[model samples]
Target: MSQTPRYQEIRDDLLARMCDGTYPPGSLLPAEPELAEAYGVSRPTLRQAIQLLADAGYVEKRRRRGTVVRRRKVEQRFMDALMSYGADVEAQGAIPATRVLQARIQGASPEVAEALGIGEGDPVASLMRLRYLDEEPAVLLRTWVPTSVFPGLLGHDFEREGLYDVFAESGLPVETVRRVLEAALPDPVEAELLAIDEGQPCFLFKSVGRAKTGQAVEYSVALYRGDVNTFTVTLTTED
Candidate 1:
């Protein structure tokens, strides 16, 4: 192979090391300068190799912390179905729990109204929660439900179970959910609640779940710890 393919070769070698448990999960790898010297390549070439590893989910780059090997991701199926967060976590063999921080009836903010497709000033059930996985805080979820669909939802104790479970118990059938994911810096409140330092990046998700009749039932905005969780989507060709 040509020397131009050297970066690819380096990336492959590093990946092999990871697979063979040389670096192990959560272990920091050598700096670019050290790696470049060891591999007989320039810093840019070494960086390109590192980028390949990072993109493949084998490693992560933190601001103050150096590059570290990532733990194996929990493989979650994205089937076209509605499932509760508790069920999903249990399927992965992890204990899940939710702590309700706040629950109340609130007027729809402009952002909530746009997402839920409801008029401004309409009443919405605002539910804020801190979700835990195996007793570790994993995500901060804030959801708004149009009161017109599920009246008096704010009166229930959501900390004991997921909102989707309550919906099913109330005879609501969720047929479709639209989700968007992005990265954002956690705000002060979010940072405190999520137990993350300020300016740290978090995965932000906005989801709109609708009933079988196509009426929007819930709009949720969630922040997940970037270091501990990852979202995976699988695509197959439809015949």
Candidate 2:
């Protein structure tokens, strides 16, 4: 048989080592020259293999730290269904909890009002929460909901469950949601709340949920630690 693809071979070998615990989390791997020599491949080829691992979220290359194994990937299911953040964590067998940092009725900003389809002066329930996964602060959530739709929602205890769960309990018809993900440097407040170092990069998610009647109900911005959480999406093609 023809020789296995070079990159594939290199990738498989490194992955096997990782799986067998040769390189545990936060452990550094061999340098480029050393890896190339051991793999009997050129430096460029070995570099490509390392890049592949980095893209798969298995390793991180720091300028001075060399290449180190990253923490295990968190599985994220992306189905065409509505699920709460708390429920999602529980499904993965991880303990989920939230610390409500702020909750009150506030006049909707122009941007928030437009997203929630409410007047600018309308009252909106604003909440800030720090979500923990397995005792680690994982995400910082800032959410706004139109008070006209669910009065007194700001008084509920969101530390025990997600806002989406409360909305479902109230018989709100949550039909669809739109989400966008991007990388950003955490602001001072966000960095402090998420327990990340100042100016660290994070994955920012902006999402809007709407009722079946096409009324926008929720507008939220969430910041997740890049080193701890990864957002995943699956797509199928129609021929």
Top-lDDT candidate index = 1
TM-score of each: 0.68, 0.69
Best by TM-score: 2
Candidate 2: give the clashing pairs: none
- Alpha-carbon error at 236 in model 2, in Å? 1.8
Backbone clash numbers for all candidates listed? 0, 0
| C-alpha lDDT values of all predictions | 0.83, 0.82
lDDT of 1 by residue, 58-140 (tens): 89887656897876544334334567778877888877789999998989999999988999989999999999776667789
What are the runs in model 1 whose C-alpha is more than 4 Å off?
1-81
Alpha-carbon error at 159 in model 1, in Å? 1.4
| lDDT of each residue in 41-102, candidate 2, tens digit only | 99999999999999998998876458878765445453345677777778877777899999
